[model samples]
Target chain A: MSELSTAAAVFISIGVAFDLIGGLGLIRLPDIYNRLQAATKCVTLGTCFILIGVLIQFGFTSIGVKAILCLAFILMTSPTAAHAISKGSHDFGIKLWEGSVVDKLAEDKSKE
Target chain B: MMKKMLFHFLMLFGVWLLFTWTLEIPDVIAGVIVSLILAVLLNSIFDGEVTSLLNPVKLFWAIIYIPVFFYHMMVANLDVAYRVLNPGLPIKPGIVKVKTKLKSDLGKTTLANSITLTPGTLTVDIKGEYLYIHWINVLSDNVEEATKEIVDKFEKYIVRFYG
Candidate 1:
């Protein structure tokens, strides 16, 4: 394989490892907020790295350009979706983990 | 109005070219026709002067912002990965409210997204000048310090264009 392909392979491997860790985090985390933190950040970065690898492997061809576009789409949308889910769960009265150290939102709401 | 229409047409045509990745005469003709029609229909939805998108200063900051954002994202991934893999999950998660200096919707949204993707913080909601964030590790209960840590980094760059 070419040097470029070797580089791509390295990136793809890193991405896959992060993705596996993200899944493990989802199962191990204590509550909805914690799980969202693990799942969103790790998986989003993992997928971005995978897309970067694809772009590198494909060069500037259509496939490479599409990979870049997918990366942009994911970067913009993934966090927004996670933010929406967290807000929704909070509004639905889902409690934070018992070990949580603070609840400023609750305090703010109670103050009004 | 005409400028906005032209701007939208060009933007849509650029996407069409990216999607098709072809330069055949027939493909060009179809793209032009489709984008022109859509541009006219969608131009009203776009607020502000479309010319602002072409500003050199704003464009320059945007270029600079991408790398900084990506670097933070990489750091965040590694931090979370380490926390997830550790035998004892050492997390002190909490939802805390932090204030932002950004006034524009665009700036605030970008700041929130940046915080969510950065180390140990996920934006829960935005209320006016304040953002309620779910921090994986609550380093400081003080709103000013948390804002200094989380919002200031991205806001410095984001304010240049989006603010």
Candidate 2:
């Protein structure tokens, strides 16, 4: 196998691993907020790294640029989208796990 | 006028580099013209929060911050994975309001975004210096520790950048 092909395989494998890790996070985390964190950051960063690898394999063509553009868009938008969704869920009053240390928001609001 | 034009031109130049990956004269000219048009349109529509592109020092820091964020993402991912796979619902979920020291709107936004980005926590709302976060699990019911973990890692750097 060529060096480039091997590297590409490695890149794709890493990307797939990130995606799997994200899925696993959703399953393992105690609640929704935590799950979103895994899905947004670990998965997104992993995909970005994998895409970069693919771009390197493509050797700086328009296709490579497109891959980079996709990566950039993901970086900018994913967290924002996740934030919106999580906030929406919170507004709906999704319960947090049983062990909670603080309720500062409620406390501060009452003080005001 | 010249300074404004140069600023717009540099932006266009960056776009051109991203799009075409070429430095040929035609590409540079095309980039300059397109950027000028964009600048004019932006100048007409833009209001509030103007930032300069020539600040290489700030850009250098931004470049540094991304990798740091990546590392945090990896850690969050691992933490979440362990929680999900554990047989016991050993989860402690709650919403806590933590005080934020970040001042700028952009800085706050970035901080909120990062908190939501990390696994096991979400930013529910932002009011003044306080962030309402819904945590999936409370490792030890230590809201202060959790707040420190996030604010120290994410918020501080975001303040350094956009604030």
Candidate 3:
């Protein structure tokens, strides 16, 4: 009921909402690339917000410091993992959705 | 070489202190030993002037960049959420190549990561000076325009430290 806890609760709620939207996007998006775009951006920020909320609730305690460290690790690693997955799938010849506007990578490869 | 080793040692020891969160004599001694060993083994990985890590101007810019990055990331999350909730699902996805003036590995990697987290773009791969990004909305097919839109915002900040 205190102001601090209320602030934490609000951030936590927003994080959960983003996470749910990311999950919905994974199912609703038409292709792997589109899915990666939605899932990586939303889920990363979602988890980061949750960690921020935890940090706020715990202050500078060991648990709070660990939350910040975990947030940094996720921020650095999540997009790298997504990049690797997208690159791997593209190399394996997975086709883009027909709605895609351009395929610059494919064009470059063909030209080579 | 000595400076690089010392820099690495300090960084490693700082992490060790954070993990243990106790300043007992025994813990400090153990941290120093472990950090020294790792620093000796891994110092070669750092190619930049190790002293640059301590530069005040660069550190200031790096601190400023954190909030800028977080703001863009929050906006990008909301954008993705909107597209997900929209009934029409207004997205025109594609792989586009964008150029970067940043030649250093650290700068390029950081730029690519920033691009992945911002707006509707996800970095697929980096080839030479060009980064291939999967864009959810195809606003422009030209290399200059795409680069301007995706890389320019972060590039200016990143160059201050990494350039």
Report the lDDT tens digits of candidate 3 across residue range B89-117: 99999989999899788888888899999
CAPRI rating of model 2 = medium
- Cα-based lDDT for every prediction: 0.90, 0.71, 0.89
Q: What is the DockQ (computed on Cα atoms) for candidate 3? A: 0.84
Q: What TM-score would each prediction reach against the true structure?
A: 0.95, 0.77, 0.95
Interface RMSD of every predicted model, in angstroms: 0.6, 3.1, 0.7
Error of 2 at B6 (Å): 5.5
What does candidate 1's lDDT look like per residue over A1-73, in tens digits? Answer: 5466988999998999989999999999999999999999999999988998998898999999889888988
Better of 1 and 3 by TM-score: 3
DockQ (Cα-based) per candidate? 0.87, 0.53, 0.84
Total backbone collisions for each predicted model:
0, 10, 0
Chain A TM-score vs. truth, each candidate: 0.95, 0.83, 0.95
Q: Where does model 1 exceed 4 Å of error? A: A1-4, B48-51
True contacts kept of 3: 0.83
List pairs with backbone clashes in candidate 3.
Answer: none
lDDT for B60 (candidate 1): 93
Give the poorly placed runs of model 2, Cα more than 4 Å off.
A1-4, A24-34, A93-112, B1-9, B22-30, B44-53, B139-145
Share of true Cα-Cα contacts across chains kept by each model: 0.84, 0.67, 0.83
What is candidate 2's CA lDDT for residue A28?
A: 71
